[model samples]
Target: MELLLSNYQPAVFKCNTPKDYMEEALKICETLKIASGYISSDALIDLKRIIELNGRPRLELLIGMHYFDGFTKNQYEAARTLNAFLQINDLGFVYIANTLKFHGKMYSFTMIDATKSAVVGSSNLGSLYDKVSRQYEADILLKGEESSLIHASLEEIITKIGSPFENVPVTKFVEFNQLLENHENVSKVDKDEKAGILRNLTGVKFEIPIKSKPKSNLNPYFGKGRENQRGYIAPRPWYEVELIVSKGITSQPGYPSNQTFEVFTDDNWAFKCETNGDYSKNFRSKDDLKILGKWIKGRMEESGALKMGTPVTDNVIAAYGRNTIGLFATKDPSIWYLDFDASK
Candidate 1:
């Protein structure tokens, strides 16, 4: 039995020349045809490449993390090289590491058997470990029963952690269109044949319809680069305003607890005032309204609502209603219209 431990500090284990120990073990493996195993959280590039070069058909198990430098120019290419090696190799080995944390920081170790000898170390399957100082960083080496225990532990961890990447169903266009249709104001718009396709690809949960109108007092206060228009309400189509009151509705600073706004846009994209700031009566300043408009615009962009020619008129009214009243007061507002071209 031969023992090879890289990354082991003499200060901790009262021994120097950890590299010497690994070299001795590698020599023993070259002489004896025995199996080997390793366990570590970090690996070196040179160690990985060396194992691939030497232990092609004899290496039993190789379990460890794969680390890389994302800032390097050949990062992806180096990764691909490693992947190709894994794909073709038929050694009875396992590679265990989180794929998600690939570009940041990673660690892994491997075990190899040569002839009648076994070697274990905390070095990865790479080429960068040729430097003496980089190879002797941690205390990772065991043999005989101890080595067997480490190998078993590595197998257990691989089984428990499993692969991170798994297939998941993506939302389709019809589903997205149906969700938007569920919203009070949005469904009435003609489903541009393209709209359904667009919504399905991106995952967005459309709000249920709320039958509310825009306040005649609240107007567009913010613009791209224009002067602030104070107390100027844009002309919008008329719609009935209604508030649904339930028992347990509360107010929060940034989020609506139990309040919602419903706006019915006519074919002409006119805004109807609803909620009338009557639920909890928390007055919002002109500046707050402007900020709310910007927030809604951002949300629209994220949800791909702007591309559908969705106007900000209804959103402005909804924000006013939500800010003025608590979030829980109005559950859902239904906006219905007969014509779509009028609004655009």
Candidate 2:
């Protein structure tokens, strides 16, 4: 059948079943010597098979990080894993994109071989291959006029993924996934009451700088004062470090730098509950702050965010947001850790 749709809920179009569509797409590329499209699923099995085929065509791929159903840890992890896999594999070039702002889903493809064809559907490549689990999904292969529309849509996505935003390299993508996994593991460790209690009262582990103006003096309540101070803000005796909970991972479009976590602290500690710059939101309970501190520290160390320069004293700062975290030096924030895309 030229126009095929899989047998699944919300029936969509496809030349083959959901399970085999990916392989079919790859085979088409192999013959056509060119393939370009977008995918939202993380179906590794299909991906592996496609790679083994050695299509070696001029292929361009864009995988969606955000989903319409909703964003979940499992989904995020799968996307990261798939991105890493694509990065290392000889599958042409791949780019990671997230349209979380609109909660957009990109479970479609525009494969151009000897002729133009498209697969538009609700199913992701990863879910399509499932035998035990069932998620009804479908896709339609289009030619002629319909294929032209798919190509145009893909061109728009490519345009947005350029300039200040660029495709993530394999090395960086893999490192970020590893560190994120480490952070999750460390977060599950038993909480140290003493350390948490102590950290709740103090922001960083190091000694507070005595020379700079104390945060309390500049603004007693910590709101106005913290907001105004940039570059280097002196800590006050009663200052508790405010950890921000970012809305999305850094480097992705619509990832909010200023997001506040709900403060859940003891009577003794309170978060300033304020916004500072584009990267931080104020306050957490003394306890939550401590956990956040430890998580951030673990994430930083494990991710190599704290890599030392020629001088051991040279260290950098690391940040954690929802599903994404990043590393940068405090002295020069311009330099990003594992910055594969230097131009961006």
Candidate 3:
């Protein structure tokens, strides 16, 4: 009747993920209702895709935290987009519980066969893919009679929390997004000025076209580096693989000014990077530079474009199409894209 979901996976202890339960429930359910502390744009997009693949299932997403802690422009935009898609298909709606603050996370699903199921606990809607943002979370998946029992209570909770949240037939998002962004700006002015990020522009695209280089400089595509691989530093391999940035691009706005940043790859991979050396030229993996090497080299190897552990010459890079990469900043600065494409 009840099952425990845990983010942590260890021997002897059964580990159930929120992703597992939700993904399954979404596929067979005729209607889904969720109340979470907050939501992510990526999560909304992903859920929308799943719902599309499954069938036309109505979804009512009630956001709680944004009403209190505030929301980013990206979140607002994502929610709007998903709502539009659902509306077009006559699927469902998204709402915010504004009158009263809410922090609980719960999901209830009504199956096509009339059975009900639910998940309740710390896991938010975005809790599935954000492995690094949150280290641990737990929840309970309820089914059969237990699920049906909770369904009514959960609807009541959503209704009470979302009460007075909006007038019938919402036209636009409340002024919460811009207000939060403005408040954040006011608070970060001094910090941004000092850090030289005052000119940082959100939702900006940055392309750093890296020209071909010899093995000594950009050794990942080539072979071993000009320097020897240190024994102790092989794990985080910070200096093991390096991609030097041009001075011109370094001066551009929206470039990561920090030494460390997270890049979400086009293929749904996350890589932590460090910008070191003079003028922040060294762009290498923050953890295990070898990973950077493996990713790039592996891509080429898979396509039979270049051999692994071989010198990736100018012709090779040019033939491969795109050598340009770097940060693609979003409205939420925390989410950056380091896209990988054969066509740059």
Candidate 4:
């Protein structure tokens, strides 16, 4: 049990080599609020336990495009049961990437809450290499907001292009078995060999290894180009601001509890305002933001407020959850805090 903590430090773990990947991840999920990972058998047992626990957490697991290679009767049954459990709890859903496009093996898992953690390693979700006494594998747990961006990126990837990995409506189990038993060239091969066959068939490529750097004393959550906390808010690449042409909901991935606004930005980035210097209260409601978004779009299309508009630095600010009131011309630097009455 190699537990770790830090303001922005990342912990590393190993499995079947030095540590048990499943066990450590299970311990972390015991208090998990929201989690996302590449689905495999390595962590399925623990995922089941976590979902069954009280106060089921939100989860989204990515089922690789070639999930049927290691198909077995018992594993099939387990998957069926797990799918049922997930649907019943409404805690999460598994997704399968479009094989035609995404063919990479996703082996990452993330647990995001007040404290964030990310694990990237050599193990898949298979029991063969996930066991304590199995093949060698390792995982890294990155803590704090530094990890939030990565987790957010994963969420964007899964939800944007993947389809639900459901067994209902028409069970994938049958299709899986058919593919397994009918492939003359690979049917006789073991699960491991079948995995290789699937990869070959899909033209999957392993990600290139990244060279690690020495640890730095600077906070990982804050970028190196830190700005003073005097007046203007710092621009976060993760928290982008954009003017959405269409009316829709916008939310930051890891900060689920923060207030969300529908207000359109000059860029597609969601707006985060300064609410008395508090972080959580910076959010605005979608409906309220839409009012402002509609106004901005109308003005932009009319070429009125945006006559000289360069999308590069356009700004549509809104104010809510406070007493501040102001609207500004594009040239007005003082219009940094844009406030509009939603009631209008």
Give the winner by lDDT.
3
Candidate 1's residue-wise lDDT over 1-344, tens digit each?
33333434443444433455444444334221111122211121222344454553323222222321111212222333343454466433333333322211112223234222123344332212222233344334454565555555544554444232121111221112121222222324344633433333322122223222323222221111121233212212111112333223313332232333333222222122222244443322121232222223323333443321123355543443332321221222332111111112
Per-model lDDT: 0.30, 0.35, 0.60, 0.35
Best by TM-score: 3
**Cα lDDT for residue 321, candidate 1:** 39
List the candidates ranked by TM-score, beginning with the highest.
Answer: 3, 4, 2, 1
Q: Count the backbone clashes (under 3 Å) in each candidate.
A: 63, 8, 1, 15
RMSD of each: 23.6, 20.5, 15.2, 24.7
Query: Which parts of model 2 have CA positions greater than 4 angstroms off?
Result: 1-4, 8-16, 31-49, 66-90, 98-113, 161-344
> Model 1, residue 260: what's the lDDT?
36
Candidate 4 local lDDT, 1-344, one digit each (tens): 22321112143333233234444443344233222223333145334543554334456666544443433333444445566577787767766554334433332334333455554444455432222222344444455654666577677677775667573232343222221122111113345633333333322111111111111110111233223442212222211122211111122222223333221122222232321113342233232222232233323323322211122121321221112223222222211223333333
Error of 3 at 103 (Å): 0.8
Regions of candidate 1 where Cα sits further than 4 Å from its true position: 1-16, 27-76, 92-96, 99-128, 134-136, 162-344
Query: Candidate 3 has which clashing residue pairs, if any?
Result: 236-288
| Preferred candidate (TM-score higher): 2 or 4 | 4
Locate the minimum summed-lDDT window of 10 residues in model 1.
232-241
Task: Looking at model 2, report the run of 10 residues with the lowest lDDT sum.
Answer: 203-212
